[model samples]
Target: MNLRQIEIFQAVFAAGTASKAAVLLNLSQPAVSKAVQDLERSIGFALFDRSTGRMVPTAEGELFHREVEQTFAGLSRLRSSAARIRDFGSGEIRLASLSALSTNIVPKAIAAFRQRHPQVAITFQTQMSSTIRDLVAAGQFDIGLTSDEVDATGVTVEPFAIYRAAIALPEGHPLCAKPVLSPPDLHGEAFVALAPEDRTRQKLETVLAAAGAVPRIVLETPYSTTVCAMVQAGIGCGLINPLNAEPFLGRGLTWRPFEPALYFCTLLLTPPGRRGSRIAEDARTLLMSFAGERPALPADLHHVPEG
Candidate 1:
């Protein structure tokens, strides 16, 4: 009739006597017998053979017992799954990232995070920085990686790491021979630029404007990877984050520290009104660890020995 009644019936059936069931269930014998009787009455049949001195199940009782066994088994599994989630031993983590970081920083951090949280389901999406901020604020993403700090209405932002932006040039470009470049050195070169609204675009524009050097803007792309590829193709030279520029440095492209070293700082963004999400915090820790005390060079970066 109810879980309590079912439990009492199970105890009585297992113990083979109402007196023994009452002792096992910590209830009086009368209470156990009443519960069993109530269950049988609700089901419209006798569940046991009363004439036998030993408790024996009727055909109907055996059929009911089969269902009760299955029901209790399912309840046991449900509690176990709930416990696992509550303990943070298993769950899904959704992440979002700016296009630049999606290809470089995220993969490494995810690799490290997976080693520890192998059971956590992880999903990733890539979008522009502004989109990342909006989604994270709306609780669509547990964690977001962005190049610039995001200050949306319902999101918390934390500084993760900073890496210098450098000039990327074709291997044969004359500026590659310069030991240290100033804005004047890059003047008049055809440029491959990020979208005008991109954070790094504003920073680089300011640096170039201050030096009175206007680049010949020929190509524009939103992703850092595309800018680096164009630079490698000799389409134009541009300033880009080392993490994005380093990988293509030696493949017919050279990276040199920009004169007024424009540094790019990565920000960790999370939904507000939550103290901390296990997934977001884990992502933050993983990114910071990959960032390390020192900045990361692009994957193909090589430190040339000093002259």
Candidate 2:
């Protein structure tokens, strides 16, 4: 009939007597008998054959209990699921980040976050700065990190970091002879450039132009990792984020400081005016802290704290 009636009926059926059912259910014997009578009358079934001191199940009762036990099994599972949701988290924290941070800083932050919230799910996506901006603006991602080249529109933005760039060179190249490279050193040398739209690339080009130096532009790409790989392959020497250069240092790759010291600017982005889950906020915090805690370099990091 009703859930309470079903509970009482199942208890009585399992215990096989009103007094025993009352003890199991923490109810009086009379109250248990009344509930059982109500359930039988509501369903119009004779569930128990009442003997002198015991209640015996009828054929109908035995068949009815088979289905009731299955329902209770499902109820038990729902209860366990509820407990799990309370102990852990319910949803995933979605993160959109640039490839520049994906390899080093972001992965470390994710690993740290997982140690505290082991059951919480995380989704990490790597894309260009512009795509990361769009994802944060549209609320497609819980948190985002992008290069300063991304326009500060639609989403809340703040200065993230301004890290110095280094020129990645193929090992044993002639330019490696120079302790540091000036625009003149790069003159007439084959070069791998970051995408033209990058502010860092534009700055490097401007410095070269002011010095009246030109390198043979052999290739261009959007990812710093690609720049490192291309330099390792001896495709051409390129200027890239030093954070991205560490992985390729001994694999036929080396780095030199560029004259006037170019730097890459970054921005931290999030959905404006929205309070996300604790998991997301904590993830963003961990990510920023990891960036700040990286080894000292020619870098200026701006850590923004929020609730």
Candidate 3:
């Protein structure tokens, strides 16, 4: 009915019980129950099937809750926009990033951005490639960084950084003694394949197939950080983007560049047709300036016109 009632209804829908909602909302169970009843009465329908001291959303209630969620999301964005207007330099920028880039590349970019706009609040979430793309496209995030190339229908993607792929080998692995490793060097060796959907794995596979090599895969993981850990334990060697592999250099692991070069570009994705807030625009500029010196850019970016 009202914003307060809508908020209470959402909490009840989420918590599934008046008592639990009460605890979450810091209200008494009766108060929570009263709020939900008031909302259902205002809507001229029962919002829940109340039988066993538990709340189960009615079919209409479920639909109503989904709408409420969307409404609240829009309200939150509006609130953020208003706060930005009150203080242009200080506002929240929500971002989602693939796990590999989240650890280093994204953090480094955020660090550089914060140096200039110290008042801007940044919230970063690390997720798998698909999820990051989805969140950004859904307006849940202002920006997304990922190694994967996304074909999101309403999102604009721009290359932000390039990471050369490297192979991480256990100290005793045969490739450890080699200064450089070619695809042939990895031939028949046991490997830790990243998830089949991972951009890094696909690139590595392309290079391997080109070099007439089919590796013996021994492990697979979604997280590059976990793959690094697996390599440290001698579980198997892995091919990783340098951004994720660089920090694991000396912990019983050795890294060598793949002979047939493999690399992935880090892309910054934003919802289409939506300009970033001023602070976000400034942050993007900072990111571009810092990322320009990284591997992904062509040699001529120094002279290229700015976007």
lDDT of 3 by residue, 225-268 (tens): 88878888888888876556556666676666666667666788
TM-score, predicted candidate 1 vs. hidden true structure:
0.74
What is the descending lDDT order? 2, 1, 3
Provide the TM-score for each candidate, comma-separated. 0.74, 0.80, 0.64
Task: Specify the highest-TM-score model's number.
Answer: 2
Given candidate 2, what's the lDDT at residue 5? 82
**Which pairs clash in model 2?**
none
Q: Could you say which candidate leads in lDDT?
A: 2
Query: Model 1, residue 91: displacement in angstroms?
Result: 2.2
lDDT of 2 by residue, 197-240 (tens): 99999999999999999999899999999998999999999989
lDDT of 3: 0.77
lDDT value for model 1: 0.79
For each candidate, the alpha-carbon lDDT, in order, equals: 0.79, 0.84, 0.77
Model 2 clash tally? 0
Model 2: weakest 10-residue lDDT segment is 298-307
